[model samples]
Every structure is written in structure tokens, then in C-alpha cells.
Target chain A: MKNLALSLLALLTLAALLLGVAGCAKEAKEEKRSESKTATETPPVKKETIILATTTSTKDTGLLDVLIPAFEKETGIKVKTVAVGTGEAIKMGERGEADVLLVHAKKTEEKFMAGGYGETRRAVMHNDFVLVGPSSDPAGVKGLKSANEAFQKIADSASNFASRNDESGTHKKEFGIWEALIIKPEGGWYIKTGSGMAATLRVANEKQAYTLTDRGTWLVQKPNLQLELMVEKDKPLSNPYSVITLNPAKFENSRVKFEAGKRFADWIVSADAQKMINDFGKDKYPEPLFTGDSTLTTSK
Target chain B: MDLIYLGFKQAFIMIFKGDRLVFEIALRSLIVSGTAVAISMIIGISLGLTIALARFPGRRVLLSLVNTGMGLPPTAVGLFVALLLARRGLFGFAELLYTKQAMIVAQTVIATPIVAGLTVAAVQNLNPKLRLQSLALGATRAQMLWTLIKEAKLPMLAAVMAGFGGVISEVGAVMMVGGNVTGDTQVLTTAVVEYVGKGNFPVAIALSLILLTLIFLVNFVLTQVQQRETSSWPKRISK
Candidate 1:
């Protein structure tokens, strides 16, 4: 009888803990809803958080660390940033899961806009992709003027190439170059890491193979890697990053903060933001990780 | 706190709505971990039995190794498997990287040691005289071993439960090896990570709750088997 009572008491304790958690969650939700409601009535009734979905390169390069805190201080809007691959970030925008998106894949961004998922799209920054490989340079792709040519050389020599097959923006760019070269990269030479740019670079470094990575991620990871830049100055390697606001009308049920998202889209291309972009990586890297969108700046 | 509540609420809704993605991820999680536990049981039980019954050289060293393996970090196991299956690694020619099979392989690696160590403990706890008695009753060596295993059935069942729990709740190895490909290699744990990374806390929470429920359900069934006719509740309540 005593044992049964003890077991029942334990069960009751577990139930109470569960209830306590649920009750706390309910209170937190109520407080947030009320805060947001009052935020519109007063200048500073409560803090507001906006979701920003962006590519990993920006975060990995430590650019967002500088930009986010600055933006928050000026606007009093807390930015909750989600750093993922550009392809996945764009998909989040399409689903209205994010308030704003900062991504590099132009084709997919256009497709997202064409689908009526985005309210506005603005060019924010630009970077370029560079081919990096082991210092040994077994493929002999150094001094190649065209990325396609470098890709072809690697294929012809059957040199190992670590491809980030995770459908990221860099992966898409790599696929485009392969398509243009008409080289069916397969067999033992072509390896898919299915990972982020940094991880793929590490895999390439480990295997002493070649891989294409964004200049931003490459520069940040350069200090740790044994690989060196082997191919650059290619027209097809230019990568442009843009910011888009998800259309609230397209996803009525989603928690899309249209006003806050639009404000962020405008703030990102402003002179202050542009200057921040230009100054980023000046001290650490030999060259800035990203160049401000000059045409957009001039028009602004 | 709200996220927790939202997670529970959303989990219930998703389950009732029969969300296709949720169902797919749940099914994949069960299949992958189930397959891994099955493989672990086969190798773990047999190896454990051998180590427990035999008086061979380095037996203590082997037992210590199994004990060390029981605590092997899942992420380390993931890295080891990743290196082995990498394109430049020895088994790279098979191209098993980033597939469900790779996830199974990693989980099996993580689970086998746990099962084996527990099985060794379970079998070792049995009376030594039982083996002699069975042998004296004209039982063959294999039959004696089988009879010994049956006597330790409860702990053997516990071994199965522990192995299943270890693999089912593991996320790092699966994420590293499976690539978390949507509609392909994605499991409940990896899906939760992906959703949380995307800032969909509600969905992440929901997936987490489902994962917890799954682990609970599997263990509940095993507990039933382990406690069969031994539960004190009925007698205590009747009194």
C-alpha cells in the first residue's frame, strides 16, 4: 500500500511539472501578444523582434554581428537572424516563414518574386566566388582566367573535387559552371559533401582537392585551411546578394511583419548600411568580403 | 515558455491533421533507428555472449573496451563514420555518404557497444550453477547457452530498450551523415534541428514532442514485457 502511494505521488509530481511548463508558456505568449498590440499605440511600449533569414556566408564572415547590433541600436527593433544556405533561406521567404531574406541566389530570388511571395526586392551587396585547392595544385588550375576552364581542367585530370551538393547558392553556381562546360562530372573524382561552404572547404582541404567557395567564407576560413586560391577573376563567379520582404498577402496565416520587414529592406541599402558593408573585413582581410551595391547606392 | 506550449499544441494539431511531412519524418525516424537497433542486437548479443562465456586472454581488456564504447559520443562516432565513408577514405568507392544507410551505420556504431555492454552485464549476473545444471541434463553447449539467456530475459529486454533509446534520440550523427535531405533522409530529430535553425520554434517544438512521445511509447511496450505479471499495482490497489 505504501509503495503504491509512493508511485502515485511520483506520477503526480511529474504531472505538476508538465503543467507548470505549459502554464508558463501560455503566460509568455499572452505577454508577447499584448506587447505587440501596445507597440503600435506608443513609441516604446515594448520591444519588437523581426525575423531575418539570410545565407550562412554573411554570418560566417561575421558581417551580421556588426550590422545587426548597429541596426538594432538605431531602430530599436531586435533582429532575430536565421543563417542558412541561400536556397533554404529563399524557400523560407517563399513560405512566409521569415519577415525578410538576405540571400545570394538571383535566379531563385526572381522565381520567388515571380511567384508573388515577396513584396519588394533590392540589391544590397555583391561578392565573388573563388576556386581554392591544395597548395600542391595537382589539377594545375592555377592562372586559369575562366572558372569553367578551371572546372574542365579538374575534370580532365580526374583530380578530386569536393562539391557542396547541399543546393546552397555556391552549389548552384558550381552546377551552372558545370552545365556550361558540358562536362558530366561523375565517378570517383566528383565527391559531394552535402554540407555548408566552410565544411566543404574543410573536406577539400582534407582530401587535397579543389572546391568553389564564396570569397567571404574563404577569407574567414583561410587562416585555418592549408588550401590556397587557385582560380579567380572570372565573370561567372560574381555573386550578388539581395534583400526581399515576404508578401503578407500571400500568407495570411503566417506571422509576417510587413511594416517592419519593409523598414529593414530600406535600412539595409541606406548610406550607413552601405558604408558598413564597404568597411566590413577591412582590418582582418586584405580585401573587403563584400562590396556595396554601387548602382543602388547611387540611385538612393 | 510560450514556445513549449505552442510546440505541444502544434504537435497535437499536426498529428490530428495528418501532416504529410510530419508522418514521413516520423516513419523515416522509426525505420532508420529500428533497423540500426536490429543490427546492433544481432552483433551485440552474439559478441556479448562470447565475451561473457569465454575465459580467453585479454578478456578484461575487451570488457573495458566495451564499457568505454558504451559512452562514445554520438558526434565523434559521426565524424569517424564520415571520414571512413568520405570519397578519399577506404570505403569511399561504395559512395555510401549522405544516405540513410550512412545514418544507420553511424547509429549502429553508437548503439552496438551499449547493447553489448549491457548484455554482458545481464548474462554475467546469472547463476554460474545454472550452466552446469543444464549441461548435466544432457543439454548441448548451444542449448545451455540458450537456457542461460532465457534466465536473464528481463535484462536482455532492458538491453534492447537501452539500445533503441540510444539510437532513436541521437541527432548529431544522423544530421552529419544523412544530410537531413527533405523527404529523403530526414528524421524527426534532424527535422527538429532544421526547423529550429529556420526559427520555426513551434514546428521544432512539435517535432520534439513527437520524438519524446515516440521514445516513451517504445519504452512503455518494453516495460510491459519486462514487468509482465510482476507489476505491484494490481495487488496494492486490491489490498
Candidate 2:
């Protein structure tokens, strides 16, 4: 009876191992089926999957969520977006991994274009950065016409200011403002948080300190934060986002995805999508926050 | 492909340069997994040995529950722990989420069951006659228990080693709980993920190579120790 029991247990263990192998095989078969279906359906027309590297602001702003679905519905081209910092996004494009990039760093984007890695950097949307701090405005530098002047006062007062130092588009803009104010913000009060926009804002909120944030992210986070807009409409505060497709002439693989990238880009600059961006922050906040370019609609 | 060669070259250069970031990541991974293994072994071995040696009415049910936990996914454990530790969750006041301590806790939860389950199986696999013989030799109950523990040491060591390996390779649990904060919580596996996401194939490849090497060394050392213990225990038991 003991021998029989041992034999049965051995057989059961062997059967379990076989079942595990079968499960793996089943998953592989399903993957193949999906791949073949896509290939066969687009026999005549080339169906390409484009990798779009864009900023988190675009996603946090709900711009890409609205625009990507519409673009996919209209063109039947699938766009897989990898949301990252503009620095990381540009690096992806440089590595020939991303077919197109929708980023906001003008200087960096221009360098990429000049380096021959990208082509046709088109301006897609514009939102200004704002100085947000505790509603108490501890520095008492609110209503400043110049963004630099507000920054100067904050520095002079040794008030706490959170800076995103992750080489992100927002970080770049923050540094530019600090440079224009001619102040090297290196003291204890000037917190150089090498983190994402969301995290930096969270830090600012926690410390009840000052921070510069894009209008979209700020609008989304406004309900939760005790911070208020301290400065806006300054020329230095203008944050223009752009979209650039990889230079297909250099990378042949990106050429196949060019059509998909162009379709997504076209949808971003479209009137309907622009309207959505314009009306994104109206309900709870009551401020439009961003103005869509009406000139594109008029030109069309 | 050309991409493969480029990735390989970049990985090679990064390793040769002794990149501070890569070293820091590797060190964190080791520390996290080591702490997890240490905690799990203590809890698993004590509970497993007690259950193995004891006779209780609900012992079978308790064993079944541990077996169920053995198959729990890292992500599920991570999410459960996250919910418990998140600001809105049960222990929200503790503010443990997104901290190294939280990662260690999640890993411990994941690995303890694996160690315990394996340990129970290991202890049970021992010959019943050995314990009977020890008792017949005028040994006290405590002495007999120590003999059984000594006999099962090899399997327990092997079980602990295997559990350590499982925790170290995991990314999801660590990422969710630790937040993969650069210079703070960024581990080797999560760094690989971030690099891959950024399309930085070279850094990803280099990290992966290092991960592979580390896993191989751990497995090699563990297998050797396990083999030595298993071989020597049987001889000692027979004598």
C-alpha cells in the first residue's frame, strides 16, 4: 500500500509539471494569433505601431487621453505613448526607439533638430507657468508683472522655493527664470528636488513653500493644494509644447511609423482637440487656464 | 541585430567605467533582498519547525493555508501591502509606503510562505525511524526535537536560499512599495525598467547583465551549501 501511494504521488507531480508547460504554450499561441490577425487585416495597407514619447504634463493635462483615442478612431493607426520627461523623451528619439516625440523643451528640441535626429518641430499648445505658493503668500510677492522679479523677491526674502531639478522641461524653465533673476538659489530655503513635476508639487504642498508649475498640472492638483497662483501672464512664463517626428531618412524603421506619427500630430493641432485643451480646466476651477491657438482654425 | 550589438557595447563600457549609479543600484538590490531573506528565515523556520514537530487538530488546515500563500504573486502582495500602508489605507498613519522599510516588509510577506512551505516539506521528508531511534536511545523529548531539527537543517537552508533568490529578482513589488526613487529607492531591477522605458538599451542591458551575474552567483553558492549540508546530515544521522 505504501509503494502504491508513492507511485501515485510521483505520477501526480509529473502531471503538474506537464500542465505548467502546456499553460506556457497556450500563451505563446495566443500571442501568435494576435500578431497574425493584425498582419492579415492590413495586407494591402501597411499598419504600423508608432512609439510616441511625450511629457507627463500632456497625460496629466488629459490632452493625449482625448487626442489619442480620436486619432486612432479616425486613422486606424495605433499609437503607443511612453510618457516621460522631455529629456528622457529626446534620449529615446536619439536612440531610434521612438518614432515621434511630443515634448516642451524648445532649446533641447532645437538642438535635437539641428543634430539631424528629428524634423519639423511644430508648436502644438501653449500654457504659461505660474508661481504657486501658500495662499498666505509668505514672501508677499504676489501680483508681480515679471516672473523674474517675483523670483528675486522670494530669493531675497530667503523664502522656501521648490525647484524640479530632474532635467525636465519644467526644470529647465525654472532654471531659466532663476538665471534671469540673476540669483544663484543655493541656500537651504531653495530646495532643488531632483524629481518629477507631480512629486515636486507634492513637496511644495507639504512644505507650504513656493513652486513653479505648468498651468495644466496645477489646475488638476488645485483642489487638493492650499497653494494659490502668485504670478502669471509674464512673457517668461509662456510654456509652448511641440511635436517632432524622427528623421525617417536616417532610421528606416521610423519611416514605416511616420504615417501614424503624422496622423497623431495632425490630430493634436486639430480644432476639436484644441477646443478640448481650451475647456479642460473650466468646471471646478472656473478659469480657462490655457488658450487654444485660434489662428490654426482661421488658417484652415 | 545592430541594436543588440550597440546595447552590448554600451553595457560593456558602463561596467568598465564602474558607474556609481549602477553600483548604488546593485548595492540596494542586495540590501533589500538580504534583509527580506533574513526576516523570512527567522519567521518561516520557527513557525515551520514548530508546526512540523507539533500535533494539533487544525495542523493540516494551517499547512494548507501556507501552501496557498506560496503561490501568491509578488504584485498582489505588493498591492495588498500598499493598500495597508497608503495614506488612505488602514495603517495610513504609519506612512510606511514608498519607503525601503515597506519594500522589505512586502518582500518578507512574499518570501516567508515560500520558505515555510519548503521547510515543512523538507522536515516531513526526513525518515520517521530517525526520531524514533533517538527517543529509544534514552533521549529526552527536547533532545529528540533537537536531533530532528539538526537532521532537517540541510533542507531548511536550501529552502531559505531559494526564497532569497525569488525575492531578489522581483520588480513589481519593489517598484510599487519603494516608488523606485532615484538615489533613494532605485534598485537594479527597477532601474532596468526605467532604462528600458526611456529606450536607453545600453543601460538596461548593462543592468540586466549585472542582474544575471548576481543571480548566478547566489544560486551557485546556495546550491553548494545545500548540497554539503544534505550530504553530511545523512551520514551524521546514520552514525
Question: Which candidate leads the pack in lDDT?
Answer: 1
Please report the candidate that would top TM-score against the real structure: 2
lDDT of 1 by residue, B102-221 (tens): 999999999998889999998998778889999999999999999988777667666866887888899889876776655457789988866644335566777787789877865765
TM-score of chain B of each: 0.91, 0.91
Docking class of 2: incorrect
Model 2: residues with Cα > 4 Å off, grouped in runs: A1-45, A252-256, A281-284, A294-300, B1-239
Residues forming the 10-long window of minimal summed lDDT in candidate 1 chain B? B193-202
TM-score of the second chain, cand. 2: 0.91
TM-score of each: 0.53, 0.54
Q: What lDDT score is found at residue B111 in candidate 2?
A: 90
Model 2 residue B71 lDDT score: 79
